[model samples]
Target: MRAVTVLGLEGSANKVGAGLVRDGQVLSNPRFLPGQTARHHRGCVLAVLREALQEAGLEPADVDCVAYTKGPGMGAPLVTVAVVARTLAQLWNKPLLGVNHCVGHIEMGRLITGAQNPTVLYVSGGNTQVIAYSEHRYRIFGETIDIAVGNCLDRFARVLKISNDPSPGYNIEQMAKKGQKLVELPYTVKGMDVSFSGILSHIEEVAHKMLASGECTPEDLCFSLQETLFAMLVEITERAMAHCGSQEALIVGGVGCNMRLQEMMRIMCAERGAKLFATDERFCIDNGAMIAQAGWEMFRTGQVTQLEDSWITQRYRTDEVEVTWRD
Candidate 1:
């Protein structure tokens, strides 16, 4: 059987990455420079697609499938890339696959790390879900009943006008590195799920009050925010491990790039004698490689989405995926 090759596009947010995958191996995975204000994501997506095509030594016509991020992203950016993807699908008359943004992260972790079965901790601006396979579907053991983890971080950064110049997360992480104290913010972890909206407001309020009274600096606030959020994520991941009876864990999504969160997760996993898997910058953030890899697997499983099938959701639950795996 001839191997199927796919050209993947990702424009879920500021970073637009493209890749070429054949039989689940990425021949090329490249991310365009992320946009700061969200206006630049469209052009970045186009440029990255061309970049990936050249890197793969293939043209648009070389692809057997065109896969793109379906939802759980900025509307303008997703629409921009979706239009390009759909047009390519129509022009090439090849199968067009739309992959879920969150699932792509988990699938990419599995691809890069070679983990058989592990709990997934997916944290990003648009999502914060802990997933495990059970019965006939992916069970969402823990999640944000409201705002997401990364979104909380971003919102706090925006409140202070912290430079989005180099990427908001990086800026926050930098500030957090300079931080010296743990301010002890609220950590609301009830059962397996968690909440961040209150934490976000609490941090902002504390920062503003302190700044006004000359009691604290932005770096202090930043450090406190990171501590609060990372603790919340670590709490959920540990609880999920106990809930799912799985020690092996995979941390996926953009927020997984944070050194602070990764460190906490690694230490937590070590305590339990469990292995923790994390992709570097490549698979950690939104990338086309994950989409291509996921598309190939779903393709084999006959999980293709129609052009008129439409987008599922931006806030769709991770547990909704019907499992075809055996325990």
Candidate 2:
């Protein structure tokens, strides 16, 4: 059998990631996305693809297939990349695979971790989920019923007027690194699912009061935020692991790139003698390569989406797809 090379494009939101993947190897990836602002993600996808192909020394024609994010993301951004991907697939006369963004994260973690059947904890601007692969499907054992963790952080950053260069989440992660005292913050965890709305509001109020008294530093606030939020996530993920009867953990999604969260998860997993697998920013955060990687696995299992199949779902349950992180 011939090895497959897929040119992938991702523009689900601010961070646009494009790459070339051949037989699961990320040959090259070039990213473009506004840190603090939204931009022409559609066009950016094209630029990323062009640059990635150049870096790989391969043309679009060299790829056997084209993979792009299908949906479960912002409407405008999702359409922006979808049209470009569909057009390229038509023009190049290649098979097109529209992959679920969340699933891509899980698959990438599997790629990097070699976790065949580990429980997954995915956190992103648009999602938070605890999942497992069983019965030929990625089952959602738990997830956020409210706002996503990264979105909560970004919105808080906006309130602080934090520069959105690189990424708002990255800024917050940096801020947390300098944090000292844990300001009193509410921790909300409902069963295996977690919520951040209350904590965001409470922290904003604390900032206002502390500034009024001129006694609080942003670092302390950042520390408190990361501490509280991460603890909540850890608690919930641990519960899900216990419920699912799995000790191995895999953290996915863009927010999974946060060092603090990774540390907390690592410590928790270590205590239980459960292993944890985490992909770095390349796979942890949103990227085109992960989508292409997941698409390749799906293709191998005869899970290809037909040409007429199209969906722009904002609330796609990750478990809806009947596939695991591995073939």
Candidate 3:
């Protein structure tokens, strides 16, 4: 029997990526994100697609199905990718599958780390959730009640006038390393969910005054913010793990690439005698391979999206999909 091959397109946010996955392996994953505009994605998607095919040394005919991110993201980018996937499916006479963005991260984390039903800490620009699989659904145990952790970090970066050449969170991470003092920040964790809006507002209001008064340096603020935020995340994640009786913890999504956050999670996992699973930026950040891998699973389970029902959904929930592939 031939291995199932999938070509995936991802444009759910600022990044636009194309990847080829077959038999649980990523053959090609090329990504580019100049901006978050639908026009930018339209300009880059074709080139990205061509590059992915070239890198994989395959043609569109070799793919068994086409997959694309279906939502919980920006409306325009989701629509753009959906339209492209639908067009490709029609032109190549292949099946089409719409994947949930959060589920893609979880599935990809499991695939790459070989983690079997680990508790997932999914932190990205738009989402923060502690999840675990139960009854065929990736059930959310805890999440951000207000602004997401990554969004908080990004906003803080903007306040500090940090460079976003690579990413705002990454730059903050680098700066935090140079920090020696820990400025006190609000730590909010109510039950299972965390809130960052209050912290962001507090920091933004005091950051300039503190800097001018020499009360604390930017590095100090960065370090303080990271420690407080990551501590809150770790507390909630640990609680979720304990509740689920899970022995493995997997971190996914864009902000999961932060070494500090990973370190904090690793420490928490160690204390509980649980293993920690994390991938580098390629898998942690948004990419096409994650979507393709997810679509591959859905397709194998006899799931496909019909043309009339292939429209984009900006608020698709992770638990909405039936995980027919998992027991």
**Residue 170's C-alpha lDDT in candidate 3?**
97
| Global Cα lDDT for candidate 1 | 0.81
Candidate 3 lDDT tens digits, 29-116: 9999766479999999999999999999999889999999999899999998898999999999999999999999999999999999
Please say which candidate is ahead in lDDT: 1 or 3: 3
Which ten-residue region of model 2 has the weakest summed lDDT? 34-43
For candidate 1, lDDT tens digit of each residue in 53-164?
A: 8898988678888888887777777877788888888998988888777777887898899876889999887889898877866678888988988888889888899887
| Residue pairs with backbone atoms closer than 3 Å in model 2 (clashes) | 35-164, 36-164
TM-scores of all candidate predictions against the true structure:
0.91, 0.93, 0.99
Off by over 4 Å in 2: 35-39, 324-327
Best candidate, lDDT: 3
Clashes of 1: 0
Q: 215-235 in candidate 2: lDDT tens per residue?
A: 767777878888988898888
Clashes of each: 0, 2, 0
The segments of candidate 1 whose C-alpha lies over 4 angstroms from its true place after superposition are 33-44, 212-214, 310-312, 323-327
Candidate that scores best on TM-score: 3
Please give the range of 10 consecutive residues that has the lowest summed lDDT in model 3.
33-42
